[model samples]
Target: MPRGYGGTKGVRRPGVALALHFAFADLWHDRKLSVLGVILLAALLAPPVVLHTLQVGLVETWARDLAADLRNREVVIVGEHQVDADLLAALRAWPETGFAVPEPSFFVTTQTARLVGGRGSSVPLDMRTTSPGDPVLARADLPPPGQAGLILSARAAAELKADPGSEISILLQRTPTGGAVERREVILPVAGILPEAHWPGRTGFVSEGALLGFGDYLTFSSDTPDYRAPEDDERWQSLRIYAPEVSQAPALRDRLQNAGFETRLMTDQVDRILRLETGLRQLFGLVLSLSALAFVATTILIQWLSVLRKRRDFALMAVLGMSRRETATFPLVQGATMTAIAAALALGLAAAMGGSVEAMAQGYLAQPTEIVRPNLIPLLAGALGAVALGGLAGAVAVVRLGRLDVSRALRGD
Candidate 1:
């Protein structure tokens, strides 16, 4: 009915395009109010964003550090229990198994050994059996296949004054039933040194064959003129098992316990970290829900009041042939635009807050780690959620607009 409401030839302008145009014009006309609304929305949204970023960042940092340690995934088979090849093979075949190596009986695991060309002091060290894929030796070079080399822990190396390319003389002693105590001195080359963080205390890691040989000599006095390697069917007294992931440690431990193996694992530590993450997320969720509800309520009240004040203007539009749907789109578009701008401002504020936290944390930490890592997916989802809340608020205003009596409002009634 109005000249400009429909284009020439009675072709109506696209409703959304026209609504958007009016929305922008109205927002610009009340630019100061719009800007104030944006500031309020951003203030409400920023705290949740910063809190979430911190939670995710700190939890992720802890998780990564725990994962990097590798020991958290390690499952130690306690005491001397016979582990046959069949059982070891079954464990190796398990999906959770990342690495598995057999350890000799406890008696032979520790022995007095001294570096040949250095301090010359014999240090009693626990010798662990290591294979090619051992997680403990991930950073260290593996010993030559068989029994020619050893990797010493930082403490052991420090006490022995040992270094790579040096030699160590280990004394292997055993007494047979009713036989004299036999002692044999064997020399092994130092292949590498393990970091203190990995092995800790006085410890040495040797090949499975070398450990087995030491066991044979100690158990059966097998170091005669002719020495033969042990058979493939030899049963090991213990095993060093590791899971590929921290999450898998619990399942693997449970599986081992179910199979009648007495084992010790860092599952408790992993579980504690996992529980902390869950608790933080739940806490954040509660805070975010409350904050979001307040934001929505405030937004809806603002939009509703704005519509009420502009009832005459909307009534005039209706008289000029603008449909209710087109009028509704005006508020929807305005709400979405304001929300998007507010979300952007909130994200920027969150980032600034996170950076401040990270800088402070870095000053105190020996090893600097990221305490404010922002992930893309969650950030995008948060922005979308803000926009959706805005749309919901606009919908409420639209409901109020739908009930407006156009003729009475236009007549100043």
Candidate 2:
């Protein structure tokens, strides 16, 4: 053995070793109680979990809405037939605007997209085309507008089992160029798939130059007055624009209004999403309040009772020359130690359960989703907090015991 390692000169001091043995001996007899205390302490570590789950669903919904809003850009609305030649020219020259085609005011639709899944088919309708440089929002596939190709929305592509170079058909309502109600089936090669939009379950988009040709429900008539299907002209719908930052949306809207466009900022698409975030915060607070109250009440009550029940054993130790300081500090040590162990167990449980909880929250969301990564701050704080609250309560409850008559304790009366 090395010179100091053998213990003649320096190992742990003998007195320190003896104290360690005695402390362990005392703790050994009470090991079951310690285990029980730890379990109780850990049970209180559940508040943060409930709150974080609510946050996950909310943030998921918020992101999808934000992405959709960004894609929609800004819309420009014209007064009824107010898009005169001069107004059209002025609007057309604006750098941010694209597809300056005339269309109606309110733009929305519900349509079914048919897919040719897993088979090879042939026909003129089977070979569709769109212009190459289509000004697409969040173009997952790069397709140039004006080229003969079709850009499908992510939902559309999925519905059609489509990919680049696949030819597909659009079912539009008919207009009689000659005599009959001709169902126009324009086949375009699938040039690209747009990103998944936050708008759920449906898909719509177009090549830059193309108007929404027509719909299946209405046929164009001449003398009967229902000639062009409603959305064929672009001027009807408000002009949509996008800014680099969300903070710029209001500013851009104001500027456009000032420029004499009858504009109402429709960020309801975005605001409705953010409203979900607010709801989540409120829900989290509700969960937190209930959880915190339970932990505080249960922990303080149990720890304080345990400390009092063990007072006589402690009082005898004091009579045997253990100091008043030792008597006062014992409950603190026991409470903190028990709480610390519970904290460790709770951390393990939280981590194991976090992913599952987050997934559940994501499923509940109405928007884009991201995986949850529970941070360490809550875990660490929870444990230490329990320790503090429990120790304080335990020590306070034992304060009267520390002042007890040694004779009464000794006389067993």
Candidate 3:
């Protein structure tokens, strides 16, 4: 008998502490069984951890890559329409709207431009209106509003042999109603160069104010001495609308369509990505649920069997004056300790498996990005759940311990 089991009041140990000591000793005495239980539990836990880590990492990485594509979140007006400031304001007020800029007619927006100091034929560049928060220019330096500055796309810059700080001459030609053709050349400094991934075609991005001014110049006679830009109430021919997130693009597109606006969006791609993510989550949830159930069942069965085998030992402890509460706590403490160790082992195994998968993806699959990274929150949560479930399982065994016939068990009946 342990010294603390039936000790005098002066030397008596705490009930829980004494039970913990006996639990550890009992586990050590049956070290092989304890080790086997830990191995079995770890084996059950590791696969789900690895699967969840990979699934979350891969899906998150894919979603991030898709979301980074500005085109996926853009809703382009199909053709020329009389878009107005009020409409633009209304669209901007929508929670789903990330950015909305009115555009001039496509006929007036395309202009022949050439570098002022370079020797290259003039190239017809499609000018797009941009504002401060334009997603297309997210990585490019935006020109100041109302300034004669241009941000040229990679193709436009290449064709003009121009870079940032270079000056480009935009030749604006328009035939006024029942009048001869009018031509005007405007030289603007290149503020920045957009990456090819942002705008691939031969395009130039100018401030909305600048585009409006150019449209006004082309629409009216250039000979007017007091050339004033169009008023804010002036209607536009098109609009460039963007959603803050790709998931919102479909809804925004539907809203525009419902309002009699024809727009184009990558809704099919967005829907596919969304569906994939949802399906993966559901599948992973089912797998995790089954795994957890199996773990609980195994823990309860194994711990109950262990308690049944040690019935006489608990009976002997009761005979030695140990309280029933203390005796019942033995299996609970042992189960918690074993499960804690198993959780650690499972985490280690998951890390190893995840590393192997990541290595394979990097080396042979040609995926350089991390695709099996484990999130700390989920890992900690899983570990805590395992320990809690293990305690619950042990509690079930403790219920059986309460039913033990002390005298009969001690008599080896």
Candidate 4:
């Protein structure tokens, strides 16, 4: 027989399988502590997991919805004076610019046939001219460029009791040279109705030529000292400038401002909303990180207590001729096993909590909330964090076991 050390030679130092077997045996022996550890980990991990899931869903949905309306976010530029054709051309040529349309006449108060047709009520409207491919109009409903008609907003149509193919009369208040106010009435047909989704206000869209012709009528029809001929009016009232995307609005606004135009962007409201969300997420993340760090500390304390309680067993193993490496490795195995079990339980608990959060979000939002399923990033972070804490505890236990005096521990002193 070939004996290597103390007449027992066939076996070398204890390997990983032996360590793992002892680890599982220890877990079964101290099942109560194992269960308590897993419960603590689950409690600590669940809330942050739920919050992370909800935040991911909300931010993604907000960004996607905003992107869908990007085409409609036209930068409106009102000059210090009225905008002119040259400015409109320059804007259309601006970098990242899509379309630039002149809105010379706006907010012309008018009466509809339904209003004068025994309805006895008038509706003030926002009127603007649109051309083909105007971002404001639905592609299928856009009137041809020279069409002489108006497209009413859904609200306007409802109030006026009008529909497509119906006629409406607009009353223009004109002041003549003698300071006499005359009401100029014009009859026009409704081309289409603007969808409620696209209606920012009680607005209407008429073809550019049709609107210019109406302006001409207002200009020369009455001998008014204040009358400005539409053709001679080089200055534009304002411009509706479309950009390729909403993200480009800030740059486009700056460019226009530098070029001597006053501009307003639709993205200002969106940016404000996004900034609020970012701030909330940042605060939440800070709280979560601190909580996680505290949990790690608590885990280290629990591991230290467990190792202290097992000192007698470690000393007995050392006395039985187990090497210092084998004795130290036992607690390491126990830590890894316990941490793995706890991480699994915690993840399951987090998933259940996430479902509840999603249901609550859907009910409160009262709209489609696009929550991502099987979100792995946060879950992985939690698992990695727990394992790292366990690894640190294992290292500490190993070092403590290495320094233990086996004789003193085994002497019951």
lDDT of each: 0.80, 0.53, 0.81, 0.66
Question: How many clashes (backbone N, Cα, C below 3 Å) per candidate?
Answer: 0, 40, 0, 2
lDDT of 3 by residue, 1-413 (tens): 56675546687557777778889999999999999999998888877887776666666556665677787898878978887878878989998898888888887688899999788999999988877778787645554434568889999999999988999999887777898887878888898898887778999888776777776677673443122455789789888898889889888998988878898785456667777788888888888898899999999998899999999999988887788899878999878888899999988877767666666545533236646476788798989999998998899999999899998999999
Per-residue lDDT tens digits of candidate 1, residues 76-172? 7777788888988998999988889888788878899998866566899888888777877774555433456788889999999998878888888
TM-score winner: 1
TM, every model: 0.77, 0.56, 0.77, 0.70
The global Cα lDDT (0 to 1) of model 1 is 0.80
**Where does the lowest 10-residue lDDT sum fall in candidate 3?**
221-230
| Candidate 4 ranges beyond 4 A from true positions | 1-22, 28-32, 39-48, 59-81, 89-100, 107-124, 138-146, 159-192, 221-234, 241-269, 280-305, 317-333, 337-374, 381-385, 388-396
Task: Sort all candidates by TM-score, best to worst.
Answer: 1, 3, 4, 2
Q: Comparing candidate 1 with candidate 2, which one achieves the higher TM-score?
A: 1
- The sequence of per-residue lDDT tens digits that candidate 4 reaches over residues 1-413 is 87555764675555556666776788888888788876776666656665665666555445455545644357766643467767667778878687676765553323233434536467776777677678767444555434657788888888787888887777666666877777666666787887766665576777665555556556654332122324534566676777777656667777888877787776565565456567758966886897678667766776777767777887877666677776666776666666767777767766776667667556644256565554688678778877777767777877777777777778766
Clash count for candidate 2 is: 40
- Candidate 2 lDDT, 61-108, residue by residue in tens: 354445545444445354534444456567656654443444432321
Off by over 4 Å in 1: 1-48, 139-145, 174-182, 224-228, 278-298, 312-330, 356-367, 388-392, 410-413
- For each of the candidates, the C-alpha root-mean-square deviation to the true structure, in angstroms, is 4.9, 9.1, 5.0, 5.8
Candidate 2: residue 7 Cα off by (Å): 21
- What's the residue-level lDDT of 123 in candidate 4? 71
